[model samples]
Target: MVPEAQLRDDGAGLAPASAGWFVLNARDARWFHRPGRGDSVPLTGCDELEAETYFPMLGMSIQVLPPGEPNATYHWETEQEDFLVLAGRALLVVEGQGRQLEQWDFVHCPPETRHAFVGVGDEPCVILAASSRQFQKDGPWGFYCADEIARRYNASAPEDTQDGDVAYGRFPPSRPTRYRDGLLPD
Candidate 1:
C-alpha cells in the first residue's frame, strides 16, 4: 500500500480532504481516459456534488435509470448534459421520438429541452451522465407529474394549508393534518 505522504499532490489539498472537497478521480488515468464497456459509475448522493457544483453550472452528475424507471421530466437553466450508457439499454424520449441507445453510446442534451430518460431493458439501465454547467441559482428542477402520475410515484404535496401554519407541519413535533369539518362542509 502506498503511504498517504507519498500520494499527496503539490499540496492542492491532494490529500483526501473532507466530505465536500474530496476529489473522486482516485482511479487510474488510462482506465478513465479510455473506458471500455460496462464502466458504470456508482450512484452518489447530493452532498458529494453539492460542494464543488450547484445550480447555474451544476457540476457533472451521473444518474442510473433503472429498468422500467423513468427520470422525472424536467429542465435546467442554460445547462447542457452529456450522457454515456455503460450497460443494459435505454432510450432518450425527445419530442415524442424514441431513440435506441446501446452500450458506450453518448447523448448530448441541451438546456431547457423537455426531455426524459426511459429505461429500455429488463435489467438495470446503466448510464454515466454529465453536465457542462452546474445547477442554476434557485432551480430548473421541477417534476411534471399529473394527478395520475402522482399516485404512480406515491408522492403528495399539501394542496391547501389554511388555519394552521405550514411550519407547524414542518417541525419535528409537527402536527398531523387536522381536518376541520367547517372548512370543507361538502
Candidate 2:
C-alpha cells in the first residue's frame, strides 16, 4: 500500500512525508545547519519519516559547503558511496590523495574507500551524495581515519577510530534549519 504524504514542521523546518513516495522541490525540503560547514538537505525526507518507514536500501542528501569547509571527517564506510558535484568547486581527498573537482564531476567510492571533501573556489560547492544502507549496520558502518592530506583541511580524525563521537568531537552538533532564498545557486 502507498503511504499517504503529509507535512511536519516542529519549529525546525518542513519535512514532507516521503514514505512510499512523495514529491517536493529541494528548496522546500527539510535542511540542517552545522556551524562552519554549510547547510544540507536530506532529499529522502528523513527528518519526519518514521523509523519503520525509512528507506531500507538507500540514503541520499545534498551537501552545500562554503569555501575551506569540509563536509565531514576523512572516513570509509562498509557500504559504497557516490557523489556528484552539482555546482562550484571542491577538493576531494581520497585514499590520501587530493583531487580537484568541478561542476558535474562524479565520484564513486567503493566500500572502504577513504574519502572526504572540502569546498574551494569563491562560491559554495554543492554536491549530491548517496549511499547504500542495506547491511551497513550488520558490521561496523564506518571507520574514521587519520591522514595528513585530510588533516590539512581539518577533516581528518585525530586518530583512527570507529566511534563517531570521537571522530566528530571537534565539530558542533548540527541543528535543524529551514531553507532560504539564495542558498542554492541558480
Candidate 3:
C-alpha cells in the first residue's frame, strides 16, 4: 500500500509529513527569514520545518536575496556545491575574486573552493542552490574564509573560524516565515 501524502502545520507553516512522494507549490512552501538579510524557501526540509531530518545525499533550497544582502558568509565545503541564478542580478565572490552574474548564470564550486554571493541590481535576486551532504570521516568538512572582498559585502567570517556562531554573530537567527507574494519574479 502507498502512503497518503499530507501537509502538517507545526505552528510555522504547512510542510510535507508523508513518507511517500509529494508536490508543493513554491508560493505555498514553508519559508524562513533572517533579519537584515532576506528569506529562503527550503525545497526539501529545513530545521525550521521541525522535520528533524535532512536530505541524506543532497540538499536544495531557493534563496531570495534582497539587494546588498548575502546568502551566506564566504565558505567552502568538502563536497561539491552548485548554484544557478534564477532572476535579477548577483555578485559572486569566488577564490578572492568577484564576478557579476545575471539570470540563468550557473556556478559550480568544487570542494574547498571558497565562494559567496551578494544580491545586487535593483531587485531581489533568486537563486537555486544545491550541495552534497555526504560527510567524511572527519565529519562535514568545511571552512569559513576571511576574504577581503567578502568583508566589503559583510559576507566574511571574523577570524577564519568553523563555528557558525562566530561567522554569523552579527545576524540574528532566522525566524519562521510564510512565503509571500512578489518574492519571486514572474
Candidate 4:
C-alpha cells in the first residue's frame, strides 16, 4: 500500500487526494447495511469504536439472515464469542456440530471453537455476536482471520439461501469484536 493509502494522514497533515488511486473504493450501494431479510437496517451515520474497556471494548453488529443462510466463514483466535438469539430460530453449527436456538437463548462459544452460523426455521434468524476486539489478520487489529487455527467450513458463502449467511463483506461475520488482550475461556 502506498503511504497515502494507509490510514495515516499525509505528511502535510491532510489526506492525500490520490489515496485511492490504487485501492478501489467500495461501491456506495454495497456499503449500505441490510441486516435481515425482513427489513433493511441502514446506518444513520458513519461510526467507529475505540478498543477500551474491562473486557476489550467490542464493536457489534446484528445480522438477520432470513431462513436458510449462514454467516461468513471464520474462526476464533484466543478470543471467545457469545451470541444472543434476538429473533426467529436457526441452527448454530459449530464445525460439524449443530444446535437449535430460539429468541432469547444465550450461546457462549469459547476461544477457537470451530463454528459457523446457519439460518434455519421459517422466520429470519437474528443474532448478536460479541468478540474480544476488532479483527484483522495482519492489519492494526492483528487478526489473521483466514489463518486462525479454526478454518472456514465453507458455511460462510452459502450456495443456497437455506444454507447460511449471505456474503455481506460489509464486516467480517465474527459478531462483536469484544475481548481484552488477556482472556482465557472457562
Candidate 5:
C-alpha cells in the first residue's frame, strides 16, 4: 500500500510529496502523461529524485505509447539503457535501423547509442525501461532525426535543430494518468 502523504493529488497527477524510500505495486504507480509523447510511470524509488541526479544507479520506468506515438525524440544517452517489451508491439529505431519488437523482446542499448520507439499495433505498447545512471555527470544528449520514416510519427527532430531543447519545446507540458485503474491488468 502507498502512504497517503507520499502521493500528492494535485488534479493533474500523483507525485511524490517528499524524498524517501517507498514501495508500491506496479498497478499503483503514478503515471504522468506527456501531451504529444505518451504516459510514463517513473520508478525512481523516491519522490525527491531529480532527473539529473544519478543516485539510484538504475533509473527505471514503465511507459505506455499509443499507436504512432513516439516515446521521445530520437536520441542517445551517455549511460547505458535497456528495455523490455511487456505488451503490444512497437517499432524500435536504433542506430538508423528499424526493428519490430514484440512482447517479451529485450533491447540493450550501449552508451551513446541512438534509439527511439513507436507503437505499431491497434493497442498501446507497454515497455519497461531501465538505465544505468552511474557516471552520469552531464546526462544524455538528443539526436536529430532527418529520416523521413521517423518523421511520419513526429519522432524526428525539427529542421535545423541544435539540441534537445529545440525538440522538447514542440511538446506540451506533461500530465498524469491513473496507472492502477487505467493501464494495469488486474
Candidate 6:
C-alpha cells in the first residue's frame, strides 16, 4: 500500500486495498516520453517513485501523441490490450487497416493483434491504454510487418528488421512532462 504521506485529498492518491495499490489523479501523475515511442503518463495503482515493481497485476497508462506521432512501432503482444480515446483524434493502424478514432472511442485488441496508433489533426491525441500482465512462455511482445499505413505516419519499424533489432538511439529518452493540463479531456 502507498504510504499516508503520498495520499492526497483530491483523489490523486486513492488506491485499492492491496499490497502495492495506490492512486493518482490525472493532474498529479508523472508523464514520460520515449524518443520514437511517444509520451505517456502511467496510471498504475502503485507508488510511481518505485519504478520496477509498482504494478504487479496489470499495466495502465495515458498516452499523448502529437500530430503525426505514434505510440509505438507496429507490433502485437501475447497479452490482450485495450485503448480508450479520451480527447482529440487519431488513426488506429491494426492488421494493415487504418481507422480514424475520436473521443470516447474504445478499441479492444486481443492477443497477437498487430496494431499501432498515430495522432491526427492539430491537437494532441490522448489515449488510455490497459493491458493484461499474465506472462507468456515465449515472451509477450513481438513486432511485425511494416505496412504502408504505418509508414504514412512514421510509426512503422525499420524495413527488414525484427523486434529488439530496431535502433532507438536516434530517439530521445523517456522523461516527465510539465503539461499536466493536457491530461484531461477537452
Ranking by lDDT: 2, 3, 5, 6, 4, 1
Cα deviation of 61 in candidate 6 (Å)?
A: 0.4
Those runs of model 4 whose alpha carbons end farther than 4 Å from true positions after fitting are 1-56, 134-186
Better of 2 and 5 by lDDT: 2
Structural RMSD, model 3: 2.2
| After superposition, candidate 2 runs with Cα above 4 Å error | 16-18, 45-52
lDDT of 6 by residue, 50-127 (tens): 422555557788888888888877777778899999899999999989999999999999988989999899888989
Write the candidate numbers in order of decreasing TM-score. Answer: 2, 3, 5, 6, 1, 4
Per-residue CA lDDT of model 4 for 95-177, tens digit only, reads: 44567889899888776565666667876676777665544323343122332212232344222222223433433433222
Estimate the TM-score of every prediction.
0.48, 0.92, 0.91, 0.48, 0.80, 0.77
Number of the candidate with higher lDDT, 2 or 3: 2
* lDDT tens digits, residue span 1-186, model 2: 887777666576666554556666788777889776788988654532452265657878999999999999999999989999999999999999999999999999999999999999999999999988876658778799999999999899999999889988998998888897887888
Question: 4 or 5, which is superior by lDDT?
Answer: 5
Which scores better on TM-score, 2 or 4? 2
Give the Å shift of residue 4 in candidate 1.
11
Candidate 3, poorest ten consecutive residues by summed lDDT: 47-56
- Model 6 residue 15 CA deviation (Å) reads 12
Better of 3 and 5 by lDDT: 3
Model 5 Cα shift for residue 147 (angstroms): 3.7
* Predicted structure with the largest lDDT when compared to the true one: 2
Candidate with maximal TM-score: 2
Residue 83 local lDDT, model 4: 83
Candidate 3 local distance difference test against the native = 0.85
